[model samples]
Target: MKVWFALILCWQLLAPAFANEAVPLADDPVVEQRLITIAEELRCLVCQNESLAGSRAELANDLRREVRSLITAGKSDAEIKEFLVSRYGDFVLYKPPVKPSTWLLWFGPLLLLLGAVWLLIRTIRQTQNNANTEVLDDTKRARAQALLQNTDLPK
Candidate 1:
């Protein structure tokens, strides 16, 4: 039992180190760091809301390898990004370029927010108008009161 407890504790302690290990990049620390930074700024096409560097998907791993190769080949960051953009289009970038092709992607949320606000305002106004229309006038209120007072007509 003591040996099993010790093994469990040891595994628990070492588990985090294994968890944090990413796909291996180039041996050069500088190039590896740059590659990681670039990869972290790219979205993984196979995973929603996960950066390429953070995603464990096979496609993300392939993209990381591609980035490492580009860095090893002495490609500047901009050149590497341009190459990726040319091949994959703007969707791979976490921060896609502001261009005609991407205007909807860039501005869609704001437009949706504005449209929702407009709809909410219109709904509220319509609800208020409906409430006003449904309210009983003075004559109707008096008639209702008379009906209540004449309750002897029905059980």
Candidate 2:
């Protein structure tokens, strides 16, 4: 009983060391809010689907720290954004400005979706047309009906 109790106590003491701890964020609410706003607008390079604010990746943490320093340095939001964009390119921004180079990113998925719809419609129509053309002739229809009805007529 004492051994079991000791083991249980050790497990309880050691469990937290293996668990994730929340990161320490900026102390001031305004600074924290600014960090969040900036982070939300930026995409995590390592987690392409998640915004930096929501990503748990190490790179995201580093980027947040960079943003915190920038805030502490009294840089305007636009200036901070510009510095990040210059360093990481437009891919870092969740909503990049529309430009000649970024036109594909803005419109490519819509074009692909429309193309898919057209192809689906065309395929469905072609299948219907083929089905219409495959109707059994009179003799074959008679044979099929006779077979269905269990007639013993020789083929």
Candidate 3:
């Protein structure tokens, strides 16, 4: 128990050494604010599902640094975005413009949903029609009656 207590004390003493330092804030708060705003509107190229502002990837950090430099250089938000887009293409933007090339991306899910709904309706109608047109011939009806009347059958 004494050895355990000594180890625990040592662990507590060394815990601060293992801790990570806080990230230094940008010199200009306005530039940081603009970086966040623009980054949130942009997708992280390395993490396709994550926004640039939310991603912790190395590429995300580098992109943030690049954006900060652009802000320092007095480029407008639009110009900064245009520059990134020119380098990385429309995939960098969270909301890419609807153009001829992006028509499939914009409308694919909606088209698939409509097609599925139409198929479901058609299948249901076909099933209903099949059920309605099913004939109960004498032999089949007698067999059904016999099954129904069998006392040995479970309820």
Candidate 4:
């Protein structure tokens, strides 16, 4: 009975050894490689700022699996990307292609920066011009002198 109890304890300890290991992604490493390559080009919809290949989000996993199947079915990388783009729109592309609709997206910041720089230069030039043209007329100068001379504030 003591031997049986010891054997049962041993069996319990060894049971985890029988637990299934994580299955290899697929039967083909090439498929996994292609999946990673394609996924790297996609943005994770749920993660917003993360790439599908690097994100741990559930949606990212689903997209990876979808890519894997597309690869396995012999779709070229470009075709796989097009498929995703068709389904998810340009937002799924980390670097969206230039189009009439997206021209502002690509160049708007540069235009805004140029505008800000021009405004700053104009403001600085205006301030310097105002400072340089500080000739007070005689009457205004006399009034300024009178105010400076009268240091007492009204009670």
Higher TM-score: candidate 1 or 3? 3
lDDT of 4 by residue, 43-111 (tens): 999988999989987788778888888888989999999999999999999899999978998999999
Q: Which model scores highest in lDDT?
A: 2
TM-score of each candidate structure, all chains considered together: 0.72, 0.71, 0.78, 0.71
Please give the RMSD to the true structure for each candidate, in Å: 5.6, 4.0, 4.2, 9.0
> Who is ahead in lDDT, 1 or 2?
2
Write the residue-wise lDDT of candidate 2 on 17-77 in tens digits.
9987787888788999999999999999999999999999989999999999999999999
TM-score winner between candidates 1 and 2: 1
Minimal lDDT window, size 10, model 2 = 20-29
Window of ten residues with lowest summed lDDT in model 4: 146-155
Best candidate according to TM-score: 3
- Model 2: residues with Cα > 4 Å off, grouped in runs: 1-8, 16-22, 135-138, 141-155
lDDT per residue for candidate 3 within 7-35, as digits (tens), equals 99999999999985654558999989999
Off by over 4 Å in 3: 1-23, 142-155
Query: What does candidate 1's lDDT look like per residue over 65-151, in tens digits?
Result: 999999999899999999998998889899998999999999999999999999999999999999888978787787788798975
Taking all chains together, the TM-score of candidate 3 against the true structure is 0.78
Each model's lDDT comes to 0.88, 0.94, 0.92, 0.87
